[model samples]
Target: MSENVLHLENVTMQFGGVVAVNDVSMDVNEGEIVALIGPNGAGKTTVFNVITGVYAPTNGRVSLRGRVIAEDHPRGKMRKMYAAGHLGEYPRSVNNTPDRITRLNMARTFQNIRLFKSMTVFDNVLVAKHMHLKANFFSTALHLNAREERRMREETMELLRIVGLENECDEIATSLPYGQQRRLEIARALSTNPSMLLLDEPAAGMNPQETEDLSAFIREIKDRFGLTVLLIEHDMNLVMDISDRIYVLNFGALIAEGTPAEIQSNPDVITAYLGVAEE
Candidate 1:
């Protein structure tokens, strides 16, 4: 079996004449925290989109566990789905849908907080479990079976405990402190039982203390859940502290890849940020 859980081979994405990601190839090995860091508009998020099936690459292949997951679409399905008004129908191909990717054991949190303001913290996480629950939509809609509902509640509680938010499970999602909201987003993602967790700027807008706490929480969740985390972060302290390996991007291309220590010493990385000549 391949050690890598995710792989991108010679991937490229173009918007008009601008190449957002250019022939970038990378991999995330199982049980590792890989950080993608770069200056603004350096294609870090573009790479994330390609991995999560948000955008199809124009040039290359994306694989999961050695299986080809995405290829260039000869005919875009979104156009047809929109024209036919069947955009919510079942996905015809793996590459064309985000749910298909989530079902394949990949889950992601957005850069922005997308929690349901009116829903309780527990309910937010519970909603994510709908993807894994065996009960059909009709069963849920009609409340036909007590067994399914009971099982769903139990599983939801379990996920809440995993994220250390069990105590505040009944609080409205928006009422929680900023740091806890970040953790809730992660718990919500975990309800799907994903093998890989993609966190987009988990530490964004956090204060120093909050950031430190979040750093510890991330490490705890990775060990307890046995997750391979791929994070895009601008917090140098957090990235250098937690990531097992680091990949740097600049202007939509991979400019450096190395361990945190190695990256800190790389002349190009330093130059990219400092714009100073190396001695």
Candidate 2:
């Protein structure tokens, strides 16, 4: 059986009384491409935020490689305010920051493209590479890390080459076409050398052709880097085409999960997306 690369057990996130993600649990096995899909306000991105450490979930645990990386349960003031998921399942809070999570072999892109607009494509990637630097602050400031810097630059170029952005390395990030800007963001995420990648609406603004190209590109990089991916996408065609398994969420709760064929036939999923018909 494939090892589970990521596991969420009874995870929930609440903002005051609003339960954005409620009692959600899912898994992504090593090397599998998993898609999280649902209608608007389904709390898809909320789950992504919880996973990426943008928010410490109000309940349950998030595990990576069988180790619990984040966990918390309703407590203090939250204890009385409409606790969701399993209550008190995790007594301690284990909120790892986003950068710390990235260092621990997880990286993500945003729902909206986030790039260093003032920086060149190469520099944008280089910044991510800085997270793995070995030299101390003093060495970096004194220019003694020159060799390491040079190596990073070379690797950045190689990554750009791999992503077909080599020619645009000198261009300002926001100056690239919309599709390429999206690719650049992914490239920057890749620079972190993650085992798992979380992509938030990667195909949000793409035309059909760009979406198709993105599907192929996602597969290519997955194989090339040996990555396990979890993505949120509304484009059903791309989701169905690329996902090894699909997890459906409605109103922050998982409604269905199965292969593409099974999900396509599921009544709950159909009703969630299209609503009930009058008799």
Candidate 3:
């Protein structure tokens, strides 16, 4: 059997009285391209936030490679006000910071393209490589790790080359076309050398050709880098075309899950997206 890369069990996120994600459970196996899709406000990105440690769930647990990275139970006001699913089952509090999670061999790109606007494309990627540096703080500060720095830059350039951004390396990051900017963001995430990648709306602003190219690129990198991918996307064509399996959500609740063909034919998914018919 394939190894499990990421898992979420009975996960829920409550802000004040608003429950953004409700008792969701999902998993992605190594080498699989899993898609989490739903209509707007279905809590897809909220799920991503919970998974990446941006928000500690009000209840439930998140695991990576059999290691529990985050777990919590309702407390204080929530304990009395909200009916938190799976409460008391996961009593451990292990809320890791985002950087801590990234250091655990996982990386993600944002829904809105976030790049270092003032930095060059090369520099943007080079900065991400610093997380893996072996040199101490003083060695880096004193410039004593010249050899390692050179190797890092070389790897950054090679990464840019692989992502078709080497030609734009010297250009200011914000100066690139919108599609290439998105590509650069993913390339920056890859610089961290993650085995699992979470892409949030990667094709959000792309034209048809760019979207097509992106589908190919996602598959290419998955094979090239041996990556397991989980993505939130609105483009049905792209999702159906690439995903090994899919999970559907509606109103913060998981509605259905199956292969692309199965999701396409699922009545609950169709009703969630299209609404019920009148009598």
Candidate 4:
């Protein structure tokens, strides 16, 4: 019963001599909108990949709630190298596939929109429901799980309504306006029924008005679905307006973490973004 919805403990990712994430650790508590913000090459997305199991940590642990989902380390000669004089920051760790991690009350959307291009909007959302489908293979093959089908339909429609995408249900997923496609991606993620939602650059290509609407929509869904959201965003305005707490990264290391106001004032954060001035 830990209050933290997600925790990354001493996480590090090393490729040969380069450490993409250097002993980075952070927490997302229940019902909080937390953001990871950084300049390009700051390793923000690397942390997300570790959390979602896209890449196992070279060393460190990733946990959702209280269960350890992913852990990794150097292998064979790498192990021997580390043992001799090159120790991984933390220790050996475990790793989980993306799907397995998704089932543990967590789900995420990509930075780029990754919809099923040929599928209808409804089917894109409907496809996520397959994760929670209760019908067995035989029941599914025989179409005997009428109850499950009805439930899935009800769930999908409810999600579409929640995201204001009900009218687009029959449209081709790729044909929707850019903003709606973003909304649809979220709706699809929502269909997985995750308690926590991880959004990567949800405002990437949005205009000021769209970003404004998206910020509001995100907050609305957090309240409506009772979700704890951890987001990676470059839209400073949106990040500042919506985040309860913000974590800043520079060169694969956390430089600051605090409330939005505090993050704004941190000298290190300013330096990271604006760079050092000549003396």
Candidate 5:
């Protein structure tokens, strides 16, 4: 296995004539928390889109586990293979589909909470297990497979416990406090059994105390789940405190890549944010 779980090389994406991401290359090593941070319109989320198959890159390539999914040449034709139902052949794609990526052991949380608001907190996590559940829809709908149904419920409760939400299993998702909702989102994503987790602003709308607890929770889950996390966050404190390495993007291009301490001292990052040279 490669040391890196995800790799993007000279990747670019454009909407009409507006380039959202340009010639950006990055590598996320296994079991590390890598933060992608930049000001608005810096193409932070654009990079995420390309990697997660939300948008096909106009140029460049994306690779996962040594397979090229997107590239500048004929190899970029892997996208066609994916479209043709040869889903197992490609690990990356210029236009890879999201479902295929999820099946590849990569799962992501959205910038906005996307829980089943009408469902219980436990059900929110339970829904994710559907992808891995072995029971057929027919068996589940008819309740003919008692064993499978029981197994699913057990798995769901176990996942809730892992996220520390076992007690809130029956509460409506929207009724949970904001911070717990965020934790529920993480638990839901984890139910997919992902090897690589993509978190988009997991700390958004969180108070200081909540963010503090979230920071520790993230680290704990990373260790417990043995997951490699690629996070997009604007909270400098959270990013600096938790990420092992940081990648800074500006104007759809990578500006700097370094450790937290190094990024804290980088003049370009300060300039990009404050529009003034560091004293």
Candidate 6:
């Protein structure tokens, strides 16, 4: 089996001539933690969108587990042009929905907390679990699959325990403290049993102590679940500490890709984050 779990090849996304991501290519290897970091609008999220099937690239290909999941003008009108130029390489069919992508054992959490505000914390995780149910809707509607429901409930409780949210399971999702709410989001994502996880700014609104706890929590899950992670975050310290490799983007372009130590010493990377003075 290939060591790479995900690969983006020359992926370019243009929104009506406004290029959000330009000819960017990167990879996430099996069982490694990788990070994509850059300025506020450096197309980090755009790349995430393309990879996750939220949008198809104007020109490029995206692969997961060596399978061409999306290619040839994905969600837009760029298909024939792309295939005409690349032929066999771009013949991949478009139109894998976000839900379909999740079933491929890839899951993600948004930068903003997107928990079910009205649902109890437990119910939120249960939602993802129900997706894997084998019972048909007719069986579910008639309450004829009580065993499935019971097993799902047991698994949901186990998942909450693993994420340290067992105590908050009964609370309304939005009622929890900010940090706990974030934990709940992670729990919800994990309910799908994804092999690879994508986290968007998991520490975005956290304080130092919360961030510290979150960093540890992320590592624990990665190790315990035997999962690979690709994250988009701005917390340099956290990124440097946990990531095995880093990819830096600036204005929709990839400027650098390396380890934490290498990225820190690269002059171009320094200039991208902090400007160079006129000499």
Clashing pairs in 4: 70-94, 71-93, 71-94, 71-95
Per-model TM-score versus the true fold? 0.89, 0.98, 0.98, 0.94, 0.88, 0.94
Q: Residue 246, candidate 6: how far off, in angstroms?
A: 0.1
**1 versus 5: better lDDT goes to:** 1
Worst 10 residues of 5 by lDDT: 81-90
* Decoy 6 TM-score against native: 0.94
Please give, for residues 1-279, the per-residue lDDT of candidate 5 as tens digits. 439889987776666546677678899999899999999889988888778888776667788878765554213433342221222333343456887788788889988888898999978888887777677888878888788767878988988888899999999998999899999999988988899999999999998888999999999999999999999998888999999999999888788999999999999988888897558
TM-score winner between candidates 4 and 6: 4
Off by more than 4 A, model 6:
74-89
Better of 2 and 4 by lDDT: 2
What candidate 3 gets wrong by more than 4 Å, as runs, is: none
Candidate 1 error regions (>4 Å): 73-94, 276-279
- Which has the higher TM-score value, candidate number 5 or candidate number 6? 6
Q: After superposition, how far is residue 196 of candidate 2 from its true place, in Å?
A: 0.3
lDDT for 10 in candidate 3 is 95
Q: What digit string (tens of lDDT, one per residue) describes model 1 on residues 120-183? A: 9989998887887777778878888678778888988987887789999999999999889999
Q: Per-residue lDDT tens digits of candidate 6, residues 1-279? A: 439999998888777646788878899999999999998889999999888999977767888999887785434454433322232455555658889999999999999899998999999999999779999999999999999999999999999999988998999999999999988898899999999999999999899889899989999999999989999999988899899999999988899999999999988889999989889
Instruction: For candidate 5, give the lDDT.
Output: 0.83
Ranked by lDDT, top first: 3, 2, 4, 6, 1, 5
Lowest summed lDDT across 10 adjacent residues in model 1 is found at 81-90
lDDT of 3: 0.95
What would the per-residue lDDT of candidate 2 be over residues 1-279, giving only the tens digit for each residue?
A: 899999999998999999999999999999999999999999999999889899998898999999888998887888899557467568888989988989999999999999999999999999999999999999999999999999999999999999999999999999999999999999999999999999999999999999999999999999999999999999999999999999999999999999999999999999999999989
lDDT score for residue 241 of model 3: 90
